[model samples]
Target: MNDYYGSVPLEEYEQILSNREYWDNISGEWEMCSKMEDKLVRLGTFVQRGGDLNRVIALYAGGREYTYRVTIQHCIERYLEALTNKRVDNLKLRLFKLEKEEAVKLLSEMLKVSIGVDFRYDKYTSRQVSFGVLDTRWLDAEGILTAIEQEHRQAHHDESVEEVRKRAHTWIGDSWW
Candidate 1:
C-alpha cells in the first residue's frame, strides 16, 4: 500500500513530473495517476484536474485508491499549487494588484485554516461516514429515512432525520459564499 498523499515533501512531486511513466503527455502534462475513472486503464485519457492550463494525475497503485481519494477531496487545491509551483492565492499577485501588502493580508489569512472533511461509505459495515469527523448521516437513499419506514441495515446509526437535516443545513450554509 502506498503512503497517504501529501505525506511526502514537495520534492517528490518534482520527481513524479520528471518520470515519463506518470504523465498524460498533453500540451503540458497531466499526472496519469490522478484521474478517478478507470485510473491506470486510461493512463493517457484527457480527464482533467488542476483547473485552467493545469492538468491532473491518475494512478493504479494497488490498494492506494481510497487514501488518495480521501486526501484529494480535502487538499487538492493546495496540492495543485505545489505541483504547478504556484501559490493557490498568490500573495505576490495580490500585492501587485493593490500595489501593496494590505490587499493581500486577508487572502493570506484565509489560507491558515486547514480543515478537511470526507464522507466515506463503508459498504461492508453499511455505515455512512460523514464530514470526516462525525459518523453521522445514516444514509437513506430511498424514502425510508426514519426507523418507522426503514429496512434492516447491517450497521446504522440512530441519529434522527431532523438532527441530520440540521447538521446538513449548517454544513451547507457554512460552505456558502
Candidate 2:
C-alpha cells in the first residue's frame, strides 16, 4: 500500500537503509546531470522569453558536440510551449538534426567514457528521444510511499506505540490540529 511517502516492511528496515545508501550514490551522480539540465532549461527559457536566438545559439555553439544534452536543454528552455503543444519530442528531433552526424554517432562513445550508460534510441524513427537523465534514482511514487510506510512500520516495531506517538508530536511540537 502507498502513503504519501510509501511503506516499507518492518523486517526490511535494515535492507531499506542499505537500499537508501545505494540510491544515495546514484543520486550523487544524478545531481551533476540535474544541474546541467537546469542550466540548459534556463537558457531555453531565456530564448523563449524574447531573448535573441543568435546569442542563444552562440552561447551554445561550441557545445554542439554534446548534441543530445544541448537538445534536451533547449527543449526544456521552451518547456511550456513544447509540453502544451506536445512538441517536446519533435523539438528534440529538430535539435538532433542540427547536430553534426558524427557527434550524434559519438554519443554512445561519450556515454561509455563518462557515465558508463548507454544511449538508447533508433535514429531511423523521427520520434524525439526522451533524455533518460534522471535526478533521483527513485522516481516511483508508489514505491516511495511504500518505503515510507515500511519505515514507520519498522519504527513501530522497534518502539512502543506511545513512544512513536510522542516522537511524532515532538517533531511537530505546537501543531494547531
Candidate 3:
C-alpha cells in the first residue's frame, strides 16, 4: 500500500456528519450543556493553536459548525432560563435544528441584545480564511480567556441548577431578565 498520511477527505467529514448512529452514541455523554460549552472552548483553542482552518473545515465540518452553534445556543438557553425562570427547550430546539440562516439570525439577535456582541457571518468566514480565533469578535481575547476560565471553575464545582439560574439573573440584571 502506498503511504498516505494526510488529512481525512471532506467526504469522510460529510459521512460522519450524516451518520445518525455516530451522533446518537456521542449525544448521551453531552446531556449537560456545560459539556458542550467546554467542547466549544477546546475547539476554539484548537483553532487558536495554529490548527489549519481549511483543514479543520474539511476534516470536521460538523464539529466546527456544531461548536459555534451550540455555544451560542447554550448561552441563550441559560440566559432565557434565568430571565423567565422557565426552561426554554423550544428555543434550544430552534437553535440546534433550524436551517442555518434562521438559526444564525436568532443567535445574532440574542448575542447582540444580551451581551453587546456583534455576531457576523463575515467574521466567521474571515476566521476560517485566516485561521484566527473562531468568532473572537464576540469577545476580545482577554474576555474570552476570562470566560473560559470561569467556565472551567464552574464545571469542577457542582452547583445546583437553581443556583446557576440565580447567578445568571445577577449577571444580566433583572431589567434585562
Candidate 4:
C-alpha cells in the first residue's frame, strides 16, 4: 500500500471513471469516511482528512466503468478542487433518492434560486447570484459573458435555458457591470 495519505493510481482512476457502479460505491465510501472522520474528531480521535485532487481523480478513474456514487463524488470533488484548490477534508456529502414530485419541487426551487438575478439588466450581481459558484470553469468572466451575449442575441430572448450560463458568463466578465 502507498504511504501517501491519498494517492490513486492512474489506471485505477480510469477504471473507476468507466465503471459507474464502482464509482458510486467509492463515492459512498468517501462519504462514509468523511462522516467517520467527523465522528472521530468529535470523540477526540484523529480527524481523517479528505482526499486531494489527485486522490479524487484517481478514485474517479478507478471506477469509471460502473454507474455509482463515485461519479457524483468525483464531480463534486473535482468541482471543489478546481474552485477552492483544497480537499474535502471537512464536508458532508449525501445522496438522496427523491420521488417524482419531490424531484420536480427541488428542481423548481433550484431554478428559482439560481436565476433570482437578472444579470442582463442588473448593474451589480453578487457572486452568489449565479451558477458560477457551482462550476469553476466559468471563472473567465469576460469570455463567459461574451458567449452569453452572443447566445442571447442569437435566441433574441431575455431568458432561456441558457440563462444561467449567460448570467455566469456575464458575472465573470464584469462583476460590477
Residue 56 lDDT in model 1? 29
lDDT of 2 by residue, 1-177 (tens): 012111333223223222211112123443453344333233233322334333333333433344222342322224223223344343333323222222222221222222211244646875434332322222232343244445555654655656545534422222111
> Could you tell me the lDDT of residue 139 within candidate 3?
39
lDDT of each: 0.28, 0.31, 0.34, 0.31
User: Which 10 consecutive residues of model 3 have the lowest summed lDDT?
Assistant: 1-10
- For model 3, the stretches where C-alpha displacement exceeds 4 angstroms are 1-26, 32-34, 60-177
- Model 1, 1-177: lDDT tens per residue? 121322433344334432223322231224444542222212111111111111122232223434332332113233323322456454232222221122212222222221234567769879865431111133221222122123222233565667545533432222111
Instruction: Spell out the clash pairs found in candidate 1.
Output: 31-56, 31-57, 32-58, 33-57, 33-58, 33-59, 34-57, 34-58, 35-57, 35-58
| Candidate ranking (TM-score, best to worst) | 3, 4, 2, 1
How good is model 2 by TM-score? 0.20
Candidate with the greatest lDDT versus the true structure: 3
After superposition on all C-alphas, the RMSD of every candidate to the true structure, in Å, is 20.6, 22.6, 16.9, 19.2
Error of 4 at 26 (Å): 8.5
Per-candidate clash tally = 10, 16, 0, 32
lDDT per residue as tens, model 4, 107-148: 222222222111222245433221111222224422433454
lDDT by residue (tens digit), candidate 3, 9-120: 5444334323222122234434433343333333333323333323332333354444333333344345334333457653443233222233323333332322211223
TM-score of structure candidate 1: 0.19
